[model samples]
Target: MTKIRALSEADLPAVGEIYAHYVTATAATFDETPPGLQEWRAKAEGIARAGLPFLVAEVDGEVAGYAYVAQYRPKPAYRHTLEDTIYLAPGRTGRGLGRLLLGELIAKLSGTRARTLVAVIADSGDPASARLHTAFGFEEAGRLKAVGFKHGRWIDTVLLQLDLTK
Candidate 1:
């Protein structure tokens, strides 16, 4: 059975493995180099310490995915906005885990200082991600063409936002 729960500090190594796959296998993320496991752990720890939601999907003792929300910007004006990120294990895509995580995150974030959640997806045939966000009532707010470069090509970014206050 798959269980979803808060990500403890010890879960970062597994989370890093899931993130590493994207650096080499796909352009889902714009990160060209996967950080070391220690760095990744610290990142996760910081998110958790900030009172933000960082969750993991564990299936029978193995972490299948992780998701979290980060501050949209460093400005005080953006305090009520957050950007979401989700990464699944290499072979764990298409299992509806992303939906589960996103849904849980929305519920948790809605009660916090964040009033809006944004997902900036790489717009290159990534319908699964778009569909997941849409299922959570996130609407397409904007699209920036050629704003990101990965895998030797320019990739567009689709901005999807969910208004948690309403």
Candidate 2:
């Protein structure tokens, strides 16, 4: 059975490993280099300190995926808007883990002051991510063409948003 819960500091290593796979092997993230443990821990701590949700999905005591929400922008005017990030382990896709993690994150955000949730998918080829966001009520907001170059190919970012006030 898979379970979703708050991300703990002890989970950072596995979380970092899961993310490193995407950073190095896929266009899911535009990060050219995988962040180190210290950097990853700091990011998680900062997000938690800001009173946001950082979640993880564990299968039989192993971290299979993780998700979190962060302020859409640092400006005060954007306080009510949060952006989401979700990642699953390399062999963990197509098993509904991403959906579970994201669904729970969205549910948790609904109880907070955040009024909007944004998902900035890094590549147009990622239809599964787009479909997952859409299934959770996120709509296509815009698309930025060739906004990133990774692995010798130009990539497009698709923006999707979900209104929590509804």
Candidate 3:
């Protein structure tokens, strides 16, 4: 069975590996360089300090994926808004696990002060992500044109938003 749970400090290594795939292999994340262990832990620490939700999906006994919400910005006025991030291990995509992880995180975030949620996806042919977000009531906000470049080409970012207060 695949279960979703809050990510603990011990999960940071697995989470970092999943994130490193995007950092080194694709445009899913805009980060051009993958951070080291300490840097990644610091990222996790920042989320914990903000009282935000950080989650992971375990299938059987292995970490299959990770997801979390980070402060959209550092300013106080942006406290009510949080950005979503979901990363699945290689060979683990298209299994519907991403949707499950994201669903749980959104539900958990609803109980917090975060009233708005956003997903900035970089893939142009990513239908699974769009479908999952739309089914969960995340509207298509807009797409930024050529805001990033990865894999030797310009990439556009598709923005999706969900209003948790509704």
Candidate 4:
């Protein structure tokens, strides 16, 4: 069985590992280097300071994925807007885990003050992530072409937004 729960202190290592896979193996994130546990801890701390939710998904006993949202920008004017992020463990895709995490993440965010949720998806020749966001009512807002270069190529990013006010 799969379970979704609040991120715990012990979960930091797993979270860092999950994100590292994308940093090193995919264009899903622009980070050329994997962030260490310290960075992940800082992020979790910052998210806590902002009164937001950070969650992890467990399949049986191992962490299978994670999903979280952060302020889209630091400006006070953008406080009501957030950016969504989701990543599954290696070999965990196409198994309904992404949808599970996203569904719970949205449910958790619905009670917050945020009005807009944005997704910045790297166009790494895969539409799965974009399709996942759209399936949850996110509409394509814009696209930036060749903005990120990695793996010997340039990547475009697709922006999708969902209105939480509705």
The local distance difference test score of each candidate is 0.89, 0.92, 0.86, 0.92
The TM-score that candidate 4 achieves is: 0.98
Predicted structure 2: lDDT: 0.92
Candidate 2: tens digits of C-alpha lDDT, residues 1-166: 8899999889999999999999999988999899999998899989988999999999999999999999998999999999999999988999999899988988887668999999999874769999899988899999999999999999999999999999
Flag the better candidate by lDDT, 2 or 3.
Answer: 2
Model 1 Cα lDDT, one tens digit per residue, 32-131? 8988978877777778777898999998899999999988887989988999999889788998899889988888886699988999999877788999
What pairs collide in candidate 1? none
For residues 29-94, write the lDDT of model 3, one tens digit per residue. 789888888987888888888888888999997889999899887899998989988889999999
Cα TM-score per model: 0.96, 0.97, 0.93, 0.98
Task: Rate residue 2 of model 3 by lDDT.
Answer: 90
**Where is model 1 poorest over a 10-residue stretch in terms of lDDT?**
41-50
Give residue 84's error in model 2 in angstroms: 0.4
Show how many residue pairs clash in every candidate, following the order shown.
0, 0, 0, 0
lDDT, residue 54, model 1: 90
Ranking by TM-score: 4, 2, 1, 3
Q: How would you encode candidate 4's per-residue C-alpha lDDT over 123-152 as one tens digit per residue?
A: 998899999999999999999999999999
Candidate 2 Cα misplacement greater than 4 A, ranges: none
Off by over 4 Å in 1: none
Lowest lDDT 10-mer window, candidate 3? Answer: 123-132
